[model samples]
Target: MENERNEDPTDWDQIGFIISSKYRTAVLEQLVDGPSIPSSIASRTSLPITHVSRALRSLRERSLVELLVSKEKRKGRIYGVTEEGKRLWERIEAEGMVD
Candidate 1:
């Protein structure tokens, strides 16, 4: 079901899917300022760490976010919006999709 949705590749559908989740939208909003690890995003968004992690995974699957750094260890993984993500985010903001 999720794989089917990911295969669509339509910008509107992608944007709609992203904005549909508050957690995902919050994470993207936070990333707009700069790259951040999950903890930082969780703190800023006031969402739990686990929720943040899940949101990151979903965003990554959609190619709207990328992991900037990943060590052999579990910590210090950084994430930022991709170029396509930046453009879509701008549209999301410009069109006032978020409250």
Candidate 2:
């Protein structure tokens, strides 16, 4: 659903969906800075690899993040934020949702 209209970061539903989960917020926050592998994300976010992987999966399903490498390669798969993700992040920042 990458083409879906999530242009409004001010959308309360979308904002609530994101801030409701710390893992999702942290994962998205990390990716917004740049692309990185899951392990690196886990390390930087200080979260477990399992949590990072789950967050990535959820974010991918929402079109907020995407797989940047060959999915079949398995290990060291890279992920980056979508334009929509950046928009959401901007709103989250503006609202001071996270520390």
Candidate 3:
């Protein structure tokens, strides 16, 4: 489904579908607060490390989030919303789409 194209690329309704998984949404929420690594996200959200890793992978596949840096001794990554992600997030918030 990643290859599906929308007439409007900025459509949150469509982007949301990709990121609508409960865990994925939670991951986005964690990133919303600030840039964080997977371990921090798991700790803060009370999610398993493996689940967070899987969610992050899915999010990256959809271009909703990005890996910032992984250097030195830090094996984790910092994730943040992309421009496309921000636009979709704004639209979702404006539409009161959150449960």
Q: Who wins the TM-score comparison?
A: 1
Compose the digit string of candidate 2's lDDT tens values, residues 1-99.
664465554566667877888999999999999999999999998999999999899889888899999989899899999998888889889989978
Better of 2 and 3 by TM-score: 2
Please identify model 3 stretches exceeding 4 Å from their true place.
1-13, 70-74
Report lDDT (Cα) of residue 27, candidate 1: 95
What's the lDDT for candidate 3?
0.76
Query: What TM-score against the true fold does each predicted structure earn?
Result: 0.86, 0.86, 0.75
Which pairs of residues collide in candidate 3? none
TM-score attained by model 2: 0.86
Better of 1 and 2 by TM-score: 1
Global lDDT scores for all candidate models: 0.89, 0.88, 0.76
lDDT of 1 by residue, 1-99 (tens): 775576546878879988999999999989888999999999988999999999999999989999997645479999999988888899888879999
lDDT of 1 at 45: 85
lDDT: worst 10-residue window of model 2: 3-12
Q: Which candidate model has the greater lDDT, 1 or 3?
A: 1
- Separately for all candidates shown, the number of backbone clashes (residues 3 or more apart, or on different chains) is 0, 0, 0
> How well is each residue in 1-99 modelled by candidate 3, as lDDT tens digits?
555464475574555674567778778777867788999999998999898889888878878788888544358668887776666766666667766
Q: After aligning candidate 3 to the native by TM-score, how far in Å is the CA of 89 from where it should be?
A: 1.5
Model 2: residues >4 Å from true position, as ranges?
1-10
